[model samples]
Target: MQNDDKYLKSKNENPGSGMPIDEMHELDRTLGFKERRYIEELRILTKSTAIDCIIDDRFERIIYVVRQGDMGIAIGKGGDNIKKMSRVLGKRIEMVEFDEDREVFIANMFKPAEVASVSFGERDEPVMVTVPERGDFGLAIGKGGSTIEKARILVRRFYGKEVGDILIPNRGNL
Candidate 1:
């Protein structure tokens, strides 16, 4: 729940890339070193309210901590930061913000793709996200199932929730 505890928990849950980042030896760890430096670099370049940078099998998505009313500064002026990061990292870059509320957090994860609703199932089960339209389906799920994996990992890390699936209604049927 505390800031330090959050990163520690995040490192544990997101083992694919989190590594061991503790208050004592963050810079000593290779993964921690790289991530911290990258985050700083992003901050200097974008001057945004970034929380952290998550590197996953799919691509990198920078997480920011924007205030509730303000739109995210995650994407810099005219998306310049995103473009530069994409060129520098050689991977598609996505952005999301951290929220105290899990439902809002889930909505942030699937940004640009409007979420109609979000509800949790049984404990230790998946969380469901409803999108407004079918066209947003692919973007919510990501190419090759990567985005959903990112969502699941982050959910587990941040909220201790494991997402089994992000279901989209069949607009064709309607």
Candidate 2:
């Protein structure tokens, strides 16, 4: 009987721990509850649409992307909602607006310097952007070209492609 039991145990012991599906389900349930509550709180506070919520357990942070016509309303009066949410969640909360129009979002990203256009270069490839003249090209590129570089990195990191070119339109060209 003891030998038989040992053989069964050995057979049941999977090499890869048999995929933690039960644990994942539990985590999903917990996250769902938290997300629902957070959405409710946000609705009460701002009356804006919470487009998406990303909970990063490793960083202990919650990133909320909201679709709002007015950023002020999403942030709340005097940043009260953000403060409250951060305190309640016990995690840093970052807010970003979700624009229905892709152009609007891209334009918003290149602040101060107006973006003329954003066009995809190739499939699974980099993007090409056109920006208006804004005094210092260095500023547009950012310190040590960090700004544009970071944007490129983010594009590749998020979209799985590099940005082929970034063109700043010259007054002479126009």
Candidate 3:
């Protein structure tokens, strides 16, 4: 995740809107040219504003955190929008509906995995995620650990925290 600085945080402006830019952290302000293009493209194609975008080259994926309530529109019926974006960008596209609550947001990041609970750690400590089943554990972690890695990078980027572990209750040898 060395190039995670390219994980751009949206500046809350339209491409052509002549609005004043809001304050952003120095780290959040380091969007690369390609990331800016991706963000703009997301807005144009999906008609949904992406709050953050992570260009994960290792997995050849583009992870977008879209504004809450925009997930359906972004994905479109039968996932047509995602399919189109994937074809256009030459990369897998994943979207997480943004949430203001850190715990809920972390849980949402593990979508399709049935997260049982999210336990937040104290300052600078890693958070713990509990899934309902062993199958959920595998799904949340993903092939070659890609899903969990993406979650870890994004949690650190957006929440300034880490995901210490993802586990299934009453399961052993995972």
Candidate 4:
């Protein structure tokens, strides 16, 4: 987004600190030329609204990070962009505005699903996230783990936090 933190720009060396050099290299390799092309096409599709996009192959999803207030622009007047892009890319497309705060960023990625909390653990271990109810948890995880896969990837890429799993609270104990 236009108001997003400057660190998220591609010119920056890293989105955040403490990224393993190996993971960075692997990300570039994973993206390669083909994947990068998809992102490029999307950038053109969204015009100047989107800063970048993520092609999460593991989950078959494409996430576009639009400028702070341009989600509508990326989505088009009536979701034409989503329909056309999905048809072209053959993957689910989601548009989310950019944010720098760790918690806000994670919550935005899991839109329509409420996040109870996000806890950071050991340096090498994945972080933990708490959600409520089976239905909301399903939303957080997506139809076949599509959304959560993006959550993990973006969390790592944006905040350098590795997310392990999503947890649900015990309502019976309350």
Candidate 5:
């Protein structure tokens, strides 16, 4: 399907658009009734706009992609908003700040884990994320690969990209 010509314009070509990449790039990110409800609940609770919401039943969590610059509000003072939202939603709450840059967005998804670099693989291959430290590998991947899986899902949702895997120095793909 053809995206809006405006949505296809690059930042350099459309300077000062004041629109986030997620909004600019049209994808198959249609929200379901439950996802919409969750987003509405979060907006009421934190007064932050969620551009996308993913319900990962296997992980028992709802991941909200808050607009950039609105994380502080979505998180609220001392993370009260997240705590409250989690309680109300009856699941773990994960908030990722929206970023126009693909690399920065990937790094944001793997919070607390310092990403050394983000690289794209060959055609049909997944994106490769490198962590600074060996320990960070586990942190980025999360227990049972939940973190990486979630990151892959969101990356595909917004960018239509895949996360091949994460790697660290010395050791190969994990």
Candidate 6:
């Protein structure tokens, strides 16, 4: 039987302009409910501090933006606070250090992947990341490929650095 309903668009179809309010609310309820909950949890966890927590619906992730003075306290000794928060929230939590200088902050995020060097080019630059001999390429990329992708976006957005490619160095060859 042929489906004649014009409103029944495929999942890939983008709801264009002039969309109904109910539709927008439905979309948020469907896709953003969990994310909103996560953001609320972060706010509750850091309510004592002046940190700003933002939930990115597009990325479905939470960012904890903290001032310099509160950074250490937000991430308690041995990361105990973060570990507890992660357990209680049941979502992957990431901390983004807010700096008046965005460039430095982006550079700091890129440090965790063991990137040996970063250089800027006119169009797109390559990032060389060093890994131990037994390092798994999958681990470097991270679960569901979210870690590296987030890092790349953070670098580009904060520093205007175009990372077209990522190179993982072979430790055995070092």
Question: Candidate 6, 27: how far from true, in Å?
Answer: 26
Provide backbone clash counts, one per model: 1, 1, 0, 2, 2, 0
Model 6 segments more than 4 A misplaced: 1-60, 68-70, 87-90, 98-104, 123-139, 169-174
Q: Estimate each model's TM-score.
A: 0.68, 0.49, 0.81, 0.70, 0.82, 0.49
Residue 160 error, candidate 2, Å: 8.0
Best by lDDT: 5
**lDDT value, residue 135 of candidate 5:** 84
- Candidate 5 Cα outliers beyond 4 Å, as residue runs: 1-26
* Model 5: residue 48 alpha-carbon error in angstroms: 1.0
User: By TM-score, is 3 or 5 better?
Assistant: 5
Write down the lDDT that model 5 would get: 0.79
Which of the numbered candidates is closest to the native, going by highest TM-score? 5
lDDT of each: 0.59, 0.52, 0.75, 0.67, 0.79, 0.49
Q: Which of the predicted structures, 1 or 4, would earn the higher lDDT when compared with the native?
A: 4
Model 2 bad stretches (over 4 Å): 1-33, 57-59, 107-117, 128-174
lDDT of 2 at 77: 82
lDDT of 4 by residue, 1-174 (tens): 233455343433444333444454333313456656766676677664555667766767777776666677678878887888899888988877776555666777788788888776665777777887767788888777777877877777665558777888884211
lDDT per residue for candidate 1 within 27-133, as digits (tens), equals: 32223665676666666666654455566644545443333333445576798777887777666676667665667877877766787878866554667888777
lDDT of 5 by residue, 22-135 (tens): 544544667799998998999888988877789999999999987778899999999999999999999999998877676787889998789999886544567899897888
> Which stretches of candidate 1 lie above 4 Å from their native place?
1-31, 58-72, 169-174
- Judged by TM-score relative to the true structure, which candidate is superior, 3 or 4? 3
lDDT of 5 at 32: 91
Ten-residue segment with the worst summed lDDT in candidate 6? 1-10
